[model samples]
Target: MIPARTTARTTRTRRGAVVAALLALGLGLSACASDTDTGETETGDESAAASEDETEVSIGIPSGWDEGIAVSHLWTAILEDEGYTVDSQTADVGVIYTGLAGGDFDVTFDVWLPYTHASYLEEYGEEVTDLGHWYDDAKLTIAVNEDSPAQSLEDLAGMADEYGNKLVGIEAGAGLTQITQDEVIPTYGLEGMDYSISSTPAMLAELKGATDAGENVAVTLWRPHWAYDEFPIRDLEDPEGALGDAEEIHVWGTSDFEERYPTLTKLIGAFELDDEQLFSLENMMFNSDEYADEQAAVDAWLEENPTFVDDLKEAAGV
Candidate 1:
């Protein structure tokens, strides 16, 4: 079982704890330059020369998700190449939607739709434009050690009795953790199963400890995440399918954005990454120490996949 944090520490320790937790799970951030001054004057000039370049566009993303930052940096780099300035901030999902609805932020590329963030879309559906999916077949999942007898969520049904009636989860309020508490436990008749929905690092620490001891443990897991690459784990089968089928990551832009920056909007709309591409990018940015530099990673990917970059540019009608 994972140790619980006091109420005070819970609030104050989230951000730092999350980063540390990710590192323990083998997801290390690259040693890239701070997002503050990229010093890409030449590319910034080109972005300005592009048709419909905005003076500046602010993008909001959920706090603690490094992948989002990496994606934003890549987009910013590309936009700079085309002459548009990008300003990115880390805010909660609520602020992101509110900012997008009120035109505080021009766009957000981290909307996990049809499941998580459904309520936000319901509220601001009309104020934002849907800009297609970037990543496909991504979903919240439950993963277990490969050697564990629990092959699926079904195997986890009787786990509470065997493993101290405790199920480890990520931070509270996270969509995946909430769903597991509200649905998975009840549907699976795990009424006695007590959930420990702590920060990602706490959960991972417990997971590591359990796996090392060959003890039964189940935790919230997701794709495009570094855990799969770092650990020997298998996704538990979702017999009830509470997790839903493969969902796409959608992009959203403020209503005025399209009219004000058609070229930039088009580029955002055209941005798409297949699983392999995204995995490669994520690995470079989060998994490997040498390749953590965001710009360097983007530059290498652009060199290797010139055709894909050209296609995105052409789709933007550049």
Candidate 2:
């Protein structure tokens, strides 16, 4: 289970590519959404445009991050309608940022800042341009099903055996996973509990199963996530400040991105989605089976929000 996309649909020339992205296990080039939008997770390495047309844009996002996945495709839909060809890539935060610096990627919508993606920006900040901070309130969390005996990370040490001594996590490289392993576990005396790193989808499936059986389960997660809305879970209190504070997720690109994409940059800079709007998009794209395609899900989401696309466009003066 690949988690929730950031699945990189690589190299299409439609000016509005919504190509099928291959999951983390493969590199054959495809479409997926990444979080770098509260955006943080993803897989694959394909980036850049397939055409010489300046209107063609290449987007990248971190693999397995829902916020990234949702917004990447949302932008794909809008750009497509506006007659701009879009090529989107999904990969790890490291890979995406690397590519962005190398000019392999044009822009990425999910760049969590001041915490989750701090290492990335520290290394690549100068090479990339900040389009804008689209959404604030993105956060990383250690969540348990609402009925669990443990209400906080500290409480887990005593009941580790009751929950099978395991804390399920998303992709190994995910920002959430890293924070859990490096910060949360040690700070909370949770080394006794087994921390497992699997794909986001795997963690989600486990979440579903645990919820279905009414079992106690813990997993890595974040705000602006579809899980909080769809799952019967609550974040464990990070009383010791292991998980860090709320963050602003930004839109990022190559250093020259703003120069080349002024109008689009303005539109992107104007972009922002609150919890309800973002959750709706993620749930539609990742949680629902209603639409068989990424673009279709985005279209449905836009229909409900009604004025989101136009509002961003208008705000950007595009």
Candidate 3:
């Protein structure tokens, strides 16, 4: 068996590489201040101010994931209402996990367990904290237009030319994309199909464009996503199980997150959203053309749900 120290050393090395890549991608150290090098002392008048400011939580939102964006904004709005400041930054998945492990980010709401993001968790699980899952039955999927001729992932290989021989995808660094490249392609013999890896927004834009014009389009997507409610899409049957099984969605944070904000942690831990609620919330945020802003969209949903925030706080005993 490998020694624990060696495994830790290997993780650290991989994490360092992730940090370096993030920096090169222009994801600089601007999201959150490092705990050890903040250059501030906890004493005197400054101490009181620091103590008050310590209630602030830094959250990292992985780009292109609508669920994370929605929940992160929701937390920020509600936390601010509760007199706690919230900072939300958009970053790639690699950068987000790295920041959480290094204490550069206080929390993030979009960790997919046992499958998507498994590699990142393996690397940084020791330094970061798992705050428990908020949503279960989360899934990774390869979706196509509902009217498409191909009904399953297996059918794509034979009729590759019918769908323009392309599979639109999200961020190249995303775990879903990694799985698609490593497992889906090989398992389904889809190496002949051209896979386009771009941002989530780009993939959505392509989907919308194709669907609008009655063109067949295939893209990587996930459940609890607004696209299902907003677009005419259906999940292709995965007989090979190349896409993996359904997993839970977790909220992860810095190691001392619980100790630093016990009440908030409790509230977050008790937080849970069923499929109807989650899908409706995302639909408001993504489907509505009027509420262009994330916060505005969340506010719209809260207005519709009416008692959701207050009810959640009461349930958490906070």
Candidate-wise lDDT, in order:
0.66, 0.77, 0.78
- Clash pairs (backbone) in predicted model 1: 21-201, 30-292, 46-82, 46-83, 47-82, 47-83, 47-84, 48-83
Order of the predicted models by TM-score, top scorer first: 2, 3, 1
Name the best candidate (by TM-score): 2
Q: List the pairs of residues colliding in candidate 3.
A: none
What lDDT tens digits, residue by residue, belong to model 3 across residues 1-318? 111110010000112333343344432212224346765443333222323335677888878888988888777766655456566677888888887888877999999999999999899989988999999899999999999999899999888888899999999889999999999999999999999998898999999999999999999999879888778999999998998899999999899887787666767888999988888878788788888577777767766775676577557654
Ranking by lDDT: 3, 2, 1
Question: What tens digits encode model 1's per-residue C-alpha lDDT throughout 7-97?
Answer: 1100011133333433344322111223356644333432443434564777775554545656766665555443345666666566677
Give the Å error, residue 204, model 3: 0.9
Clashes of each: 8, 36, 0
RMSD values, in order shown: 10.5, 11.1, 12.1
Which residue runs does candidate 2 get wrong by more than 4 Å? 1-53
Candidate 2 local lDDT, 11-104, one digit each (tens): 3333222222211222111233466765533532221221222587888867888889888888877776655768887887777888889888
Give model 1's TM-score versus the native structure. 0.76
The clash number for model 1 is 8
